[model samples]
Target: MNKLRLLVDSVWRLTWESREAAHCEELFVPFNPWRESDLCMPSLAGYLENAEPGSSFKLNLSPGKYLPQYQTDKKYEFALESFASGTRPPHVGRFYPKYLLMGYFGNPTPFRCIDRQGGKFTADFNHPLAGRFLTLEVMVREIKQKRDEKGGECLDWLDILTSGPGIEARYQGLPTDFFEDDPFHREDEGDDRAFFAQPRLVSHVDTQAQAIMAALYSRLLKPGLAVLDLMSSWQSHLPHGLELGSLVGLGMNAAELQHNPQLTSHLIHDLNTDPDLPFADGQFDAVICNLSVEYLVRPFEVFAEAARVLRPGGLFIHTFSHRWFPPKVVKIWTELHEFERIGLVLEYFLRSGAFGNLKTFSSRGWPRPRADRYYPRMRFADPVYAVWGEKLA
Candidate 1:
């Protein structure tokens, strides 16, 4: 299996495995129409309502009531177009029957449609798993007591990293709430192609930050080795003295990539659209993502791809500063503070499970004046952060 699929399956299993089980039972439910208010009941809600406390039941909902059908003479094209354009159609809220049907069936069901005479169309919204026997093993873990609330001191990224798994374990799961839903989850979703069509020669960070990044690259990267500059633009910021056998630039803009003097070759591809990298396994000695980590919607997948493309023991260096297109940045990056941001990146590396010897480094620019200090010697500066790890077998 591919790495991405394997990772997803592993996560799915882990989620179920980690649950606490107290009681379990089997049940078979039939789908039947009731009063308008009763129709809103969830498939499992009816079974749970009558069950005893601290008990769980496995439900096998009947399928005859959730059969797929065709909707003819419907203007589905416009609706689909609006959805693709990151907007909900005006009539979507009014389509209660369709939603009700889908609730009994399933979401993201198989949809087959055909264009017909005139502006009308024929569409099928059938749940892919409909009519199939499903076994749901439910578990009930009762909470008898609540832990006392205590306001412990907030630990920064440095503290968490140094304290080991005790702290880091808290960030292991998927951070779904840390991002926007659907269309917004896709960073740079709309008009991004047009926004990056032309070459805009500009440096994203200050010269000090660039220097720190270049120095890190020089220290970690070797001479005459294949490297990948992911999400690259016109400038790669590689140290002038360092030379690489091959420097491949993968980004969204063709013109900007072509203008990059360091790139031996370049490919135009949006990582958000597809996290899979277009390269043979273990092709690169190192991979670098500079000043663009905030824009990734699926960072874990991209990190896994980086590991796949890197040779065993190869390096993956990701660097970023407090500079980004706000609209394109993910919610997590904008909502969280700098220290938490580092923790988030650390979570990305840990979740990928393809790296070892992880390390983090930060550089602070010009210090703030003494009067601005909230604490003694705690001065504010333009900070640049780098998190790197070695590819593991």
Candidate 2:
């Protein structure tokens, strides 16, 4: 037999499963309930007391709906009750996939459901397989004599690419305080437009990073397709030979944008102030943000807007280097190690929930013959990192 537990608020739902049948019931425990908790649950101590090291079992559950008392004004209160009750409504039909509720902030919980009218309602919080009568399988791997270390060690760039925690996991690992710092808060928290009004016609990255970026654009971007060069300046750094149907630039400095030879049209907008892109839905084939991602106060929101403007299957690419305006960069960027910056970008893409088929590329190890002569003592060339994702078709 295998034992498992399902916790909702302060209550515990325990199950005992055998080859023949599985039995489950609720065991209310007296304790203060938390508003939100980590998704990973605690292990069952009762089952492990006598279990062998190699013992294992499997658990399977099906999808169903739960109906609970609901009032728009009392959403949180009812949501908590629904979670504790685990009540289900009777509906005779084929089993379907679990219904995802639209309302309620934070991560998705089973306590609430959204109706067609966009009204929030409390729902039964039964496990998806409650009505299907599916068998529960459990497996006991190893019962460690000593507790394992909690929290994972930060990974290097190469290790992150090869063996990933992936985008979603990395996003979840970030602390709430990680994004709350005011490193970019200026004494003159006045208009950002005034700060960027003067055009600085200098490239942020070295020649090697620029070349790598142009090369990447040449390979990934095709000719005669609409493109949005985000946070652009006097030069898009697109490949010299590449042609595009339309190239639109969005930047802060009007003078810089007017000087850009490749851009057919341009708009002066500060992303830090207004993260929303001034474009229709699916307006571009591709969107590229070059060497400027670190400056955004709300990168996840900006990435989401990028996804909204891209056509189905359109690409959004963000390339950055070690170079940045320290005063404008987010606090998290300044605190994290160089390699961990890549993970942070990955999290931005994943947190947006607006793109698919995410990937990362690096030009960290590339040779820089020109840079070597200019800065001989420099241990490495301008390290370029890019993370991209495609809009879901």
Candidate 3:
């Protein structure tokens, strides 16, 4: 069954486990001792033993007022007494999805129900689902194999250790800077590691700027081309219905890449430190870097790397917007005016000596009112521009 159902079912069974099991009575004093004589106790301890802890844990025995006494170290005893009371009051327990059940396989560590409110409730010191009984709503079974007297290495593990060869090596001439320079860079060697280690999964552009990006992508990208998504994140946001042979994502965060449904294969690498891509020469038909050029301190090396990996006649297109984290964006990007910034990017592509035809596109800012209707005092700015080039043979 799904993990959510497993968690919820565990909590449901706890109400019965605490009441019927003889063990729970051993822990706490029951409020209504007289009722125990009329009930049948069942073996629910085994069920509780396997129950996964829920996201929120609370005991509402007999659905009355909240009992603050259960908040103490003697909570197990209180829970047992409440269970025996069998009042079955409106109850609430920590059983929800989107929770991490933290525990070890062989330990007596406390199981905690952590909620969004930032409160961690430690339960009966047993598994949170320990005081419950379970009914199997569904059963899962797999085919079993009959075994012979002698057991040899399993075929799966053996095959993993003896997989066949993949692509053969062919030497493509490396760029001059490939062997001469180091591309891997760290902003500050002595400062907090978080400065560069953390991945900020956010859009680099505003909504209007994103529309501009999508428009540029739509115009430049076509069907049946192998595309490289450079500096990708949790979202690629490529224009819809564009059929491409391949879409390879290259980024820094593995978790981000793993969940990106659009990527065929993702490589986790920090380009600032090493511009050398883990790809072959002329491997992609097109390369797209969206809203990331401002962050590149070593733009020349990265641009060259992009050109090296792109096939002849392939396109290297990058779009930029007005927004950027000031500190993180290189000084050059932060200080430049619009025309200068475009020229700067254009120079990077031209200087790389790997691109053939270079071009630029600029989308003026949000539509302005007619000059005669304008208010006396205001200046607005265009927020986006894109520069691109074709890889040379």
lDDT of 1 by residue, 301-375 (tens): 999999999999999988887878876887657644454455467668777889887766555423334444332
Q: Candidate 2: lDDT over CA atoms? A: 0.56
Better of 2 and 3 by TM-score: 2
- Residue 224's lDDT within candidate 1 is 98
Using TM-score as the measure, which candidate wins?
2
lDDT of each: 0.55, 0.56, 0.49
Ordered from best to worst lDDT, the candidate numbers read: 2, 1, 3
lDDT of candidate 1 at residue 348, scale 0 to 100: 80
TM-score of 3: 0.47
For each candidate in turn, the TM-score is 0.52, 0.54, 0.47
> How much is 283 displaced in model 2, in angstroms?
0.7
- What digit string (tens of lDDT, one per residue) describes model 2 on residues 125-240? 43222323333323344443423323333322212121211111121133212344453453345577877888898877677768778987898899998999999999898998
lDDT of 1 at 127: 32
Q: What is the lDDT of residue 89 in candidate 1?
A: 30
- Top candidate, metric lDDT: 2
Q: Which has the higher lDDT value, candidate number 1 or candidate number 2?
A: 2
* Candidate 3 residue lDDT tens string, 1-393: 222112111111112222111111101111111222123122222222233333222333321121122233533212222221332211122221111222223442322222122222323332332222322111112212232224232222111211110000001111111112222233433332245457666555544456556766888888888999998876776776777889999986777777777788888777777878889999999998877787776788999999889999999987776676555566555433443355456657757888866666554424322352332242232256667888888
